[model samples]
Target: MNIAITPFFRTLGEVADVQIGPFGSLLHKADYIAGGIPVINPMHIAPDGIAADPEFSISDEKAASLKRYHLEAGEVIMGRRGEMGRCAVVLPEHAGMICGTGSMKIVPSPEKLIPEYLVHILRSPRARRELENAASGVTMLNLNATALKGLQISLPPLEEQRRIAGILDAADALRRRRREALALLDTLPGAIFAEMFGDPRDNPLGYPARKLSDLCSRITVGVVIKPASYYVDDGVPALRSVNVREGGFDLKDLKYFSQQTNDGPLKKSKMKKGDVVIVRTGQPGRAAVVDEEIAGANCIDMLIASPKEDELLPYFLEAFLNSDAGRQMALSNQTGQVQQHLNATALKGIDFITPPIEEQREFTRRLDEIRRAKENLTTHLGELETLFASLQSRAFAGDL
Candidate 1:
């Protein structure tokens, strides 16, 4: 793709006026069921594009106040805090939406800039670096309207801008297709789980139903007394509450514990090859199967699990525990005011149905196949994302 270089590069503020709305304005959180107004927050702008999260909504009163900063179809919205530089172009479908204080709205001067072109530029890595530099705060970072308005941006001719955005848009479409394929890949395991076990709550599979404790030899919470300073680079791999993924441990970035710390509790929490690890806090109901690679690793305070049983397969149990049914059970059992937690006793009481060993093995086999497919799709998507980033980088550097 060939892109013409502009006579002169300029700052975005020089070509377009930045519109700053009122400060400290609050929007009432709206429920998805109520179907009132859609409120845009930093989280709503995903890495790929705008995502429709059910959690985003605004009350009628707050919606009325947002009329002042009402988004137009072609304007761009960017997060100013936490996820700074995350940008999205407002489409007609999102015209009536309101943005929170954490996001800044940008409207380009129509004569000098194309909205789609500006969106592409803002999403580039260069713009992200600028936004990160502008962000300020000790505990939580934030970007002010003034800093955003002063950020530099290169400008091309209007015709060139449209052509460049067109090429990028095509690439973006391919990226979205890969994402949809990945989503479908994820759904396969859930579908297979539902087919094999039926609903655990309804017990339509005609399998034996028992409380989780009845099947396991032992179940316990993880070690908590270890200090943060006790963590080392290569002493012994320690599983923090965050290590457990949906179906297994993600050992990509495991923490290490020092030899000086007491290994007594660590030994007690030491996971076996077939044991199940469930997150007891933070993200509840998240569970994983402990494989041989992490057989001797100890789990942190945020996780708990059960020893492997003869009647049940660890992989099957992990899949079931991470399903929608398991999440509901964990949520109901959770107890806390600010941070919710599930103790070993509560987790033990959760009931699940177990199929025959042959059927369990069959289910696991099918799940493994689906997971392999998903892994392939995920790898392809990652490659595509890298290609997209490279294009964006080159595009902004006047080499597109």
Candidate 2:
């Protein structure tokens, strides 16, 4: 590596202290209490910031016992395992939180490096590549404090580092605003549905009732295969439970299957436009209408509910499935304790009151307008992501 390429290059260990969270031996489920000191686990660290409330918090006495693991504001916490490089900076309000197992901490010396710059460097593509190389695991990836300390980082003068961090932060803020706008948009359809039909279960309007089996021609499960069979490019699109959302589909993490792998299962569960796809596991009850864009895409562990258009439209079915009543009905029939699941047979039994076809059509027509706006915002978010990636590339390579 060219040492003179930038102002200075140093191993992270040289400029900051890298520490792991408390070991599993120190924490136990029994010690957790309500409204206690928040614990920072892998789930707590997010792109936005440390979650205000984590899944589990410990008693004040227990927290004091684990005082060595207390977090400090301006320090960074990151997942030591799973999606290796995920991290966030702690704010003053979260300074007292205890860093729990499955994460590590990085405390940058203020005189040597800025905390914002440290988070940016860790999130950049260069750091992610290095993190992947350092991680070790057969199933879930793992990162240790030693590996993090050894990460080689390029450091410019404090002023320049702050400048780059500021630019990135501004660009990030724009993306965040666009995301917030999109998130608000995501709720619009559900709001509209609730306004028009009220709750699906209560049916206070006294609309005609119909079982899902009567409205849907078929409610079939998707193909099942090993993760290794999925590809990044040039194959049939394969969606999983991860793809289905309440009001929309997430195509970002889509997988692909080759003809060799697709010959049998793919032929069986082929989807069609207007099919209402419902997740059977990993967040059961979530559903979305399959548009032309992903109509023929093969899915895994999801229910393909092909609605009878004469009685129920794809848009209306999707809205109902995502409503409060529909979610309750779906959840009730769900089996499996750890990973709740919804099979086709159970789903077919769900009773829902159908609105007048003409009314449903009018509601769908109005919904189309909102969806178009959300699509534009989603596209804008994608552009922002691309722009941020490009900026990070140049900033670190000393091209900015």
Candidate 3:
């Protein structure tokens, strides 16, 4: 049951002190020193934590002059440029870092607001929308102390706030752990491939090698689907480069095909199980094999190759394409000025040392197990993410 308790709304500035970073002129590029105080910029403030070894730093003397911008533990450091409401708390170890021009810091009043609780509210969906709506700029979005302080938040008793924060933190931890497990599982296939065949570039194992195109029946690309042909409920799955993860396909953001669609750009490009799809743009060169589940799916702007089972299996082909040497070959031959590309000819010319089909198949058996485990974790992670979002929604609405 959802319970909506009336919450006392309070402006952020009423309970916390907001301060923007130092003026840009005060910290110029020439003022940076090798060993000195690290500067925290918008890019350095990640959701995880403050980045170590910040690109620019100031001398001891300079840090003293800009000491007013120094961050403290429990204070929230936020990006003043790009992605409106992104903020991360400063850890104890990062206490003395200087806030760069692109950041702002919020110090909550200990008697009125808990820093952890404040951070949770600031990162919530409601708060993000408010922040984005309140932001202003021309080329890039921006946040100012006035805008940050004017945003209002629903306040609960200190104890209740802590309780809500604790529950959310625990849920977030589980989600993060599942994500880490998925990452580890994702790497196992690459590790096994390396152990079996060695690097495609060096060919240290002396396996018979050939041009990538030589081991394939045909190398082709998907057509660019126009806006009119895109649909969701009543068409074929349209896989784009974004849907292609390094070792797997991400089915989350799929746009579907139309009656005129399967007949258009993707006419003969319909995916088949074991067909290797390599990203031709965006995150270029990343490759994954088409699983049976999406065998008949149509794709767009991706390099597709039907591996010759007689010479090279699909598993080896994917592993090699993602291998360091194979990636280098694809990147070197890429075309296009703004959006880089890996055309069929360029992808075909990639060189790789081919291991025997038996050895490749043997490694693939273990590889498949790891992939299955990762997929399971990914599914669980998705559920946890949904739960986390639901919890955040309820907690802020005074239902938790």
Candidate 4:
């Protein structure tokens, strides 16, 4: 319907009243006589909108007392803290759900604005920027009930709002498809590993098995005495524990350290091309092969492996280290009361199967081919994701 923009562009306070629940009331702790009522929190509202899953639950008894805050099928709910300005329209399927104190419900007067249209407006960049500016806090920013209600939005006709939302929705779907494709690609390596080697625990292949220490000449922790002040724009990059991700190293976000830092521990911490870097602390067993570019880089206290034979490919070892068997071994050996950590001494004892030299080369070659194909697919997906974001930016800015 072609409603005037002036009437539709009203603050949330003008359209509906802000309701508050009892102090220290937990949404999940509420009583529900019928069944479990879905409780919405900041975490429940994803960047895309309403998440497919709910992290918490609530009962019907406590929900009844906060009836004013109860959401209808089309009411908009905005998170007021943590992830500020995240908004979602309550779906018809979620009619009985209750929202937490960190969320504020916006009941639109239907004559002026449509629920889905208002949701898009609130989630747009312009509206989010304004919310960020008004949010107050030292550690964690929060948009109070008053600030949320008083936020302004430029409204277009209901039909125009619907059209804009439709375009953005289509773009968002494309982005999701790309993400799904990338996830599928990640499964290929694991599947191949299982088929060729069988379960590492059971060792169905029954090849000659040896501890990691037997196959490698050296396995030790990286440097730890280096100072942060030695880091420079163009100097030797120090691979801290955080620089490593599950599949590979992220050189793009690397921190540099001066080559002259002389921290006494540099002798044991130098990384070579054929070395396998395994995370010993947080996210145990996560590892990656050091590529040629980062061959001489100094590593932190994380475990580094230097294999004794050219017969064993570093990539193949990395694949195994990231496998289910490697993770289980690392987790078992980890020590600590509060935060567990894996040490080089424990890692050396983890068992792995080794085929003949020729067979290892053949396996590595085939694995590389599969990884290259996955990389190509990932590249295309990233392009599609970028395109979708650009489309969203233009559509919301009224350029579309």
- Scored by TM-score, the top model is 4
TM-score per candidate, in order?
0.80, 0.78, 0.83, 0.84
lDDT of 2 at 341: 78
Give all candidate RMSDs, comma-separated.
4.7, 5.4, 4.6, 4.1
Instruction: Put down candidate 3 lDDT per residue, 190-297, tens digits, no spaces.
Output: 788788877766788898868878989888888654634466577788888888888787788788887576776557888888899989877788999998888988
Expressed as tens digits, the lDDT of each residue in 280-390 for candidate 2 is: 876787888888898777888788999999999999988877876677776675352323677888788878788999999988997999989988998999999999999
Over 20-66, each residue of candidate 1 has an lDDT whose tens digit, in order, gives: 54354343322332456666767888756666554566567766766
TM-score of 3: 0.83
Taking all chains together, the TM-score of candidate 1 against the true structure is 0.80
The segments of candidate 4 whose C-alpha lies over 4 angstroms from its true place after superposition are 1-35, 48-55, 226-234, 251-253, 262-267, 330-339
Q: Write the per-residue lDDT of candidate 4 for residues 1-400, one digit (tens) a residue.
A: 8643332356767766555432464443434234456667677788666663433655566667667666778788878887665888888876777776778778877766677766766776666778888899878777877887787654566676677778767766776776777777667667777877777777888878888888898889876554465567877887876888766777777776666652443656778888889887777778888888888788776889888766567766777778887577655643522226778777787776786777667667776787687688778878877776565555445454
- Global CA lDDT computed for model 4: 0.71
Which ranking of candidates, highest lDDT first? Answer: 2, 3, 1, 4
Q: Which pairs clash (backbone N, Cα, C closer than 3 Å) in model 1?
A: none
**Clash pairs, model 3 backbone:** none
Q: All candidates' lDDT scores?
A: 0.74, 0.83, 0.81, 0.71
Q: Which ten-residue region of model 1 has the weakest summed lDDT?
A: 24-33
Q: State, as a TM-score between 0 and 1, how close model 4 is to the true structure.
A: 0.84
